[model samples]
Target: MTEQPSAAAHAKTQADFAANLASVRERIARAELEAGRTPGSVRLLPVTKTVPSDRLRLAIAAGVEWLGENKVQEALQKSEELADLPHLKYSVIGHLQTNKAKYVARFAHEFQALDNLRQAQALQRRLEAEERTLDVFVQVNTSGEESKFGLDPDDTVAFVKQLPAFDRLQVKGLMTLAIFSTDQIAVRRCFQKLSALRDSVREINPDIKELSMGMSGDFELAIAEGATVVRVGQGIFGARALPDSHYWPGFAH
Candidate 1:
């Protein structure tokens, strides 16, 4: 079993969380201003994937209102564990299986990685049954990476056109995971691609405005490229024990 930290250690952990959250917000503000966008235009979604509930609670206490989890089971577990913290909301940011739509329908406030009609239909049925509505972002594979789970950019327009049939699932915007790389130019290209796609889609559906892109490493570039939501994990939660390859196969560290 894992040994629990002492009281001092727990206190230090909370302190670190607050400090990290502040630093990230500061960087976001700077990035937005540098890009000539309003400072608060982009939202920082702290990803709690792989983070334990105890630490997650500390993060919530440290002013994190919404937590993004990459797995349905994990997010459900955390929601149950942190049920008392009613102010906290959850967003499932991973590729969701159709079979797991019920779990998200029952609890998740938003689903950020929506890609296909099958998954949307599954979620719509469950959400309708449960009398719950969920905010959804159409995931676009802007990097054109096969490993990523998102609809092709070319297919997004047609896909969004079909979403209105699923009344329970509200199509709010688009989401993407940029190619993980050290080369800033290459990374920015992915964000730019998504932004451009969003712009094109907006011509038909004005409500589809949010662009969920970027993560701990390249969020600044994402912000400059018009990301409205950046799913930052490592920057706020410290580092994950597993490498990025564990989540994104062939992801360069």
Candidate 2:
């Protein structure tokens, strides 16, 4: 097990994390205002993938209810470590393999990368056995990058239509990883593609309205493009040991 920080260090982490959390929320609120959207309209999902479980206690104390993780195993480990924290919810925002559906079904509150029929079926079966339901977002590769794991734009509508069959999976909406670039227009277009697809997606399934896009780097652009849920890790939790791209799997959001 990773050793806990000393008392002094722990206190510092708490104070620093609380401040960062507040700052990120303020940024989200500001972005909402600039976009002409109602304040608190967009939910800030604190991505907690590689963040230490100790620091997460501080985040929970600071009133963070939802924590997003990019890996099911990591989420499971932290969830086990912090099982005593009440009202703490976990969202698996990473690519979930079919074999790992059982773990996600066991505890995750949400799964944001449902892009395949097989994975959905596996999750549904496991969730049924667990007697639980999960909120899910379909991932779309709007950046058109070969490395990104999401439904192709042309195939997303049909894929979404197949989701209602899985009673345990509540299709929330669409999600995407816009290309990681300094080009503002390119990033915005990726978000736009997901937003536009949500319109057509909602036609078949009206519940599909939320869009999970953006990361620590370009969340402001994401908000302007109609992202309802933004996955921000480094922004609120501070930097990890690895590059941001390494943490994102292939999506690098």
* TM-scores for the candidates: 0.90, 0.90
Residue-pair clashes per candidate: 0, 0
* Model 1 residue 57 lDDT score: 76
Go through the candidates in order and give each one's C-alpha lDDT.
0.83, 0.83
The ten-residue window of minimal lDDT in model 2 covers: 1-10
Model 2: lDDT to the true structure: 0.83
Number of clashes found in candidate 2? 0
Give the root-mean-square deviation of each candidate in angstroms: 6.7, 6.6
- Residue pairs clashing in model 2 are none
Compose the digit string of candidate 2's lDDT tens values, residues 97-177: 999999999989999999999999999999999999999999999999999899999999999888879999999889999
